[model samples]
Target: MPAFTIVTTSATQDSDAAEVNTLTDDFGSETEALGYSRRMADEMLGLAAQLSLDFDYSNVALYDGDLLEEDLDPDHPALIGVWVLDEEGCSYVPAAEFRESLAEPEA
Candidate 1:
């Protein structure tokens, strides 16, 4: 059976240096995986906002939905979508569209 892997990347700050962690989990379907990813990204940013802390970034990527393996790469061609902590709030960007966005400059 095919499964989806959700990859989460979170940034942390401290007096010494910034820290980052990548986590992954598998889900039975794309819909279920995306839903869980969005909720996780939202909760991470929401807590940072509530505490008035410096929030660098947190994002979740959906990858390898057609594979049953857990070793999927976040930057692999199989990436299905991404959820980012946007300025307005947590926003979901489809992988295809996100690639285009990365090519553009910020205003």
Candidate 2:
């Protein structure tokens, strides 16, 4: 069984409702999972910015066009984080802080 799970969610804004998509990946360690989360978060942020969506972590959305854009809530589905699976159950690390935990201390 995998030791960790990485979950990513994407949403396309619509007139009255939004289309949400979710994907999950399994990894063997927290380090590996966090590395993936950081990269994925960067890519999503880039995409949002390329579409001129502000990427304010509370007002950005990605669409299916060549590069669609819209305003999203703070709980935007741009990038997700890793979930640790243990004997008890699972724990989530929000996307906003996933990379922080993995960062190297500065001198």
lDDT for every model?
0.68, 0.41
Worst 10 residues of 1 by lDDT: 12-21
How close is every model to the real structure, measured as TM-score? 0.69, 0.40
lDDT by residue (1-107, candidate 1, tens digit) is: 45666666656444344344444555766787778888988887887778765545557777765443445544568898888774467888898887777778989
Distance from true location, Cα of 30 in model 2, Å = 1.2
Candidate 1 clashing pairs, residues 3+ apart or interchain: none
lDDT by residue (tens digit), candidate 2, 1-107:
24333333433333343333333445655566566655665665566557754321111122111112333222445434444322232345565665565464857
After superposition, which runs of candidate 1 have C-alpha atoms over 4 Å from their true positions? Answer: 12-19, 65-75
Write down the worst ten-residue block by lDDT for model 2.
58-67
Q: What's the distance in Å from true for residue 25, model 2?
A: 2.7
Q: Residue 98 CA error for candidate 1 (Å)?
A: 1.0
